[model samples]
Target chain A: MKFIVSIKMVPDVYAPFQIKDGELLMDGDRTVLNAYDASAVEEALVLTEKHGGDVEVVCIGSAKASETIRKALAMGAAKGYHIQTNGDETYDSSSYAQILASFLSDKEYDILSFGKQSQDTDSGLTGGMVAQLLNLPYATNAVGLEIEDNKLVVKRQGDSGQEMIELPTPCLVTCSNDMNEPRIPNLKGIMASKRKPVESLSVSDLGVDATALEAVSKVTSYEPVPARAAGKKFEGEPEEIAREVAQLLDTEANVL
Target chain B: MSTLLTYVAISDGKIKRSSLEVLSHCKSIADAGGMACEAVIIDENATSYTDDVQKYGASKIYTVEGDAFKQHQNGSLLKALTKVNEVAQPSLIAFASTEGTKDVLGALAAQLKAGVVADVSSFNFDGTKVTAQRPMMAAKIMGNVNVTGNPVLVSVRSGSYDLKENPATAEVVSVDVTVESGDLRATLREIISATGDTIDLNEAEAIVAAGRGVKDEEAKALISELASVLNAGIGASRALTESGVYDPSLQIGQTGKVVSPQLYIAVGISGAIQHTAGMANSKVIVAINKDADAPIFEIADYGIVGDLYKILPTFIEEIKKIKN
Candidate 1:
């Protein structure tokens, strides 16, 4: 079995972001592979270890994304593939999906995996678009998977419970945040990653014509959210507070 | 100018509150354009919801009823809407931005080879052009999206539009259709039940949520008070519910319930992605936290940097006065 997983490098949610007000701020201390995509990397490792096959990680970003490719190599990916771009422009979901779809259209890979959503886009739109473009089976929020009769038996997340979905070998699965625990890389693996194969590709090389795709809306600016108004704590008997609460609910919210 | 509006309906055997909110939003857009607004529903039987559909201001109800149409079958829905657009030739298509609706429509747009204006807070028209407001960069920035296409795809963020019953009589029109092989091929195997009350969080417009920062005694009081005041349901963070500070049924996050309400109030929350993933689609977010640096502040439209204990009583009084 051959597996291909998509990975992305994102800012640490805890650290104040690097790009604020459409201007450059110094990059912060920590940057990691996306949480869901990390699970995709780990799942590939687990499956490769059990089935004895090749696992590769792919990403579309600036040269800075190599930081995560190195992480994936340390986590046991056999090779790293990066398609570098010189611009800071962020493509909308449809355009990004088209670029990736074109990249994978001719590749004869058996399994394709990606994170369910990306925080920067929080739109949860890419993975499914790739599958639709490829005309292959697609599933989201796959928590578990197993190989049986040359098909993939998977567990998908629903609003409240789990659902089991089955698809053939050439299928796409998007990993949810809770899919699996991510593996930590040790010093030995970190040192060994430099020796692994890393290939660089470009949008021009892939025949990507980005000019045809237009942006309907642009994120012109960002501001720190305003603070909330003060809340008043009521101290009294539970029943008394409850009655006042009821009055407040009716008068203010018009709920009662 | 033209406008597109989308309504989300919660179906078990019928349409729900979220559905009307979507319609009211479209009514606003249509009123601006001086055009007819149509409400579309996907269900097994169309007539079950006729009276309420028009009572809620939908001048017309377009329903595709049958087994294939139930619970948002993405493939069939995409096909059905394509036919509807071909027939109606409307200026815009609107959606109510439900969880499944967002996912399904996002995919549908890619399938239809169209761009989507997602989670619009509000929209305006000027006889020939339409402009709508959207939140990006995780709700910190408010941006305007202009639609130039003849028929654009737009979805209203949950709780963004207030619902009203205009009560104009309208008739229901049904479309006959079939499910396709490509449609049934995706992974929508089943709909599982959440922990307790089986309450549909997606249908709620007002949500009151509490977190671990809520000092113990105040934790329980917060829910009861907020729910009573807002006529809203209660929700809690996984941390608080796991430590027995609250019931698990109230837990909201990546592993719990995902809700999109009109007014989302966070009490004592630190605003981790786990919790934000559940309610980031809200129309208005207000956070009350003592820690000014809490991540919840990153997404809050209004954040009160004070002890909730010192804040809730007075705030509630102020709200009462404002409304009165």
Candidate 2:
């Protein structure tokens, strides 16, 4: 069993940022492995380690993304494929999916995985798009993964419940961050990661039509979410305030 | 005239109210733009939902029914949606953002070669282009997006719009789509339904969410009692879910289900940004925690600083009294 998990380096959503003139401003250097992708990589590594296989990672970003790939390598991924981009192009989920599809078109692997959605945009589109392009059996929002008798069984979070799905080889899955906690790189693993092989390629190198990679959707501006004003606070006897608020819910708030 | 098609989602044998909300918005858009408003219901009992869909003003309804459509299998759903798209030739397709929609939205858009925007809070589709506002960076910021395609696709978040009734005489059309077993590359082995009869959090009018401070079975019982009184869905923060105190299906946060019920009650939960991101859109928020400065209080419409053990019993009793 061979695993190729698509990884990404995304803006640290926790970093303080500002919106001015409909533009989002944040520290460009503050980037990290997407948490959901890290979970995908972690799950793949766990499965391959127990099942006597190897885990590899693929990422699409600028040269700085090699650091992200290295982080996965430190988590014991055997190899990395860096699909280099200009880092300035306003690529949407579709563009990234096309690039990944083109790169994986000629590759061999048993399972393909991705984060359920990007940390920054949270569009959650690319994995299914790539799966469609490659015509593979796929599942999304996977909270758990298991390999059984040459099949990938996924426990995916659905609207109503957790659906246990089984996909044959050459399948795709998008992992949710709820799956598992990603392992931090140990000192020895970090040193080994520095020596791990990282194969780099440009989008043009994949033979995908440049026009097809053009973004069909563009983010025109960024705006702050409407703030919810804090309301009345009640700090008194438990029974008194509790009854008071309950009355307010029915009378004042009209919700009850 | 071009058509605006809304996909009516069915979950647990009932049509999702969020889907009707999306249909209502699309109907208004179609009425204002002089375009045809249509709907597609793909379910085991798709035709049974036509009357309910008609109430939302869809002039034409497409039904793709079969046992294959019983559970959400992306392969069968994609095939059915493709056939409907071909028959409807809609200029824009709208959906209520659900886990099912998230599973197949990308693949459907890719198959159709259409532009797509996912989990948008609000969207507008003119004759040519579609513009949408979607939450980004864990709902801390909103991104205004412009989409271009012959048939643009968009999925709106639940509670983004109010449901409106605009009755119409709908022409029902049955779409024929046979999904061979060979085409279903993935097989559903089983479904682990954690919340069997509990109200779905996404559709609940009110939610009672337990956090770390809800430690013991006693507290859990109190939480359940409170929910029972208010008819609210039970939810949990990641802490409770990860610790196995609550089912993962009931976890509400950035990495879990995002909910916007009319009323949200947080019990013993210190409000983290990740948890707050999911429920910040609730119409009225009430947080009860011993910590006076808990961040959940920042956005809570009614912040009660008290111990859950003491507060919940009184809260439940008071609500029950009000109801009687």
Candidate 3:
């Protein structure tokens, strides 16, 4: 039951929206694994620990992705593969998944996992796209999963509730936040992670043609939403206040 | 450009306002190119909503009927959706952003080999090309995406678009799909409704949210006070929700509810991207934090850089006077 979990280090969501003409803007400081992907990693770790298998993490991005690799290792992954020296922050999920599928074709891993969606882009496309590329059985927002006789059984969340699914062993699942609680990094685990073996392979070295990718971008502008006008306060009975609010919604705001 | 239609709903069978907003966005997309708007409804009773769908401007609807179809189960839904795709061959697909929507949509996209753009706030048309705007650094840096495939897919964040009820009537077409009883693969068991006096944040017209900057639990009493005076729902950031003082439903952020009330008031929240991405779309965003440097100010329509504990009461008093 070998496993591969993809992890991404996303910018802190607490930062301000940066919409300038020339330079990119976002929080520059702290880096945490995208929340949903964290559940994916934790699920992979839990699966490997239960099934008696070594787990490897495959991270595709610039050197910044190395932090993702280190975090995966610290979380008890046996090792990690860094697809390094590459990545534009805006790479389309199709290209990213394509690059990884090509890499996975030459490798052997039973199961694949990733965040249901990235916090940065909120595109849960990477895992699904990779699974499509590989032509494997895939599930997303899997809340319940189990292994039986080399096949996989999972419960995926739907709009109203949940669904049960059974597929062969070779598949991919994008875990959501409630999949599992991500373990906190301990001092010992962090220290031991340094000793773990990590192999960094560049896209060019891995037989990937760097120039074949498309360069696409969207945001021509980013700006803060306009402020609201001052509120008109009211002091009266609850029913009276409701009447005033109704009037405001009907007259001044005309939103009622 | 290919047009995709996303359906938005809340607990039980209520049509969420967010879904209406997503429909508005879909309208904008259809107008961008020659894209036609079609909706995929999984609710148990779709016939009752045809008038409502028309009000949202949908030209056609692919209604899936069944008790099983009522609740969203990713696997069964993926299979059912696969069946629908095989039939309708819609050029694009879309869904409202939700935990359940994200899950089934990911599987649907992968199993169908479609492209995905999740949590998009805005999108523009370039002739036949569709460019979408999504949050990159939480909501700090916006990223653009161009979908090249025929069946481009997207999930609209809650409340990002202005909802409009179009006048045209929509055609409801029922579709039959096979979903085996054994095929029920996931279990939601139950939805432990959150306990609180506050209205559901997702459904609220106005929200007054609090954060950790409130020195103690006693401070939440003030949040309730303000909410009561304004006839608004109460909300809390993830920090406060996780702090065990509030129910999970009250939590507002990327991991929680994405609220877009007409008026959003924040107390002690320091505008983190995780937090802002949830409430940035509010019609009027107001933040009050002692620290003037709080990032919340960036998105806030109004900011009073003063202690929330002191200002909230005074502000409520001021509003009370104005109302009288």
Highest DockQ model number:
2
Model 1's CAPRI class is acceptable
Model 2 residue A219 lDDT score: 95
Model 3 CA lDDT for position A97: 74
TM-scores, chain A, per candidate? 0.85, 0.98, 0.85
lDDT of 2 by residue, B7-96 (tens): 999999899999999999999899999999999999999999999999999999999999999999999999999999999999999999
| CAPRI-style quality class for the chain A–B interface of candidate 2 | high
Selected candidate, larger DockQ, 2 vs 3? 2
lDDT of 1 by residue, B80-134 (tens): 7766665555676777655456446656666666556666667655534557776
TM-score of chain B of each: 0.73, 0.99, 0.87
In Å, residue B172's CA in model 1 sits off its true spot by 3.9
lDDT of 2 by residue, A41-136 (tens): 999989988998889999999989988999999999999999998899888888988889989999999999999998889899999999999999
Q: Write the per-residue lDDT of candidate 1 for residues A110-160, one digit (tens) a residue.
A: 789888767444556678778878877766767677766667767765433
Comparing 2 with 3 on TM-score, the higher-scoring candidate is: 2
Give candidate 3 regions above 4 Å deviation.
A1-3, A9-54, A63-67, A88-90, A101-111, A131-191, A199-256, B1-11, B28-35, B181-184, B195-200, B213-231, B288-299, B302-324
Interface RMSD of each: 6.2, 0.7, 6.7
- Fraction of the reference Cα-Cα interface contacts (below 8 Å) that each candidate reproduces: 0.22, 0.91, 0.20
The residue ranges of model 2 lying beyond 4 angstroms of the native Cα positions read: none
Reference-based TM-score of each model: 0.80, 0.99, 0.77
Candidate number of the best TM-score: 2
Encode model 3's per-residue lDDT on B1-324: one tens digit a residue: 354655545346677666777777777777666777777676678667667767777887777777776665555676667877776676666667776666656556656766566777776554345578776655555565676454666777767777777766677778886677545433344443445344656667889898888667568888888788778888888787766676655778776667788888888898776787788878877677777677787776566666565566666765666556
Q: What local lDDT score does residue A150 receive in model 3, on the 0 to 100 scale?
A: 74
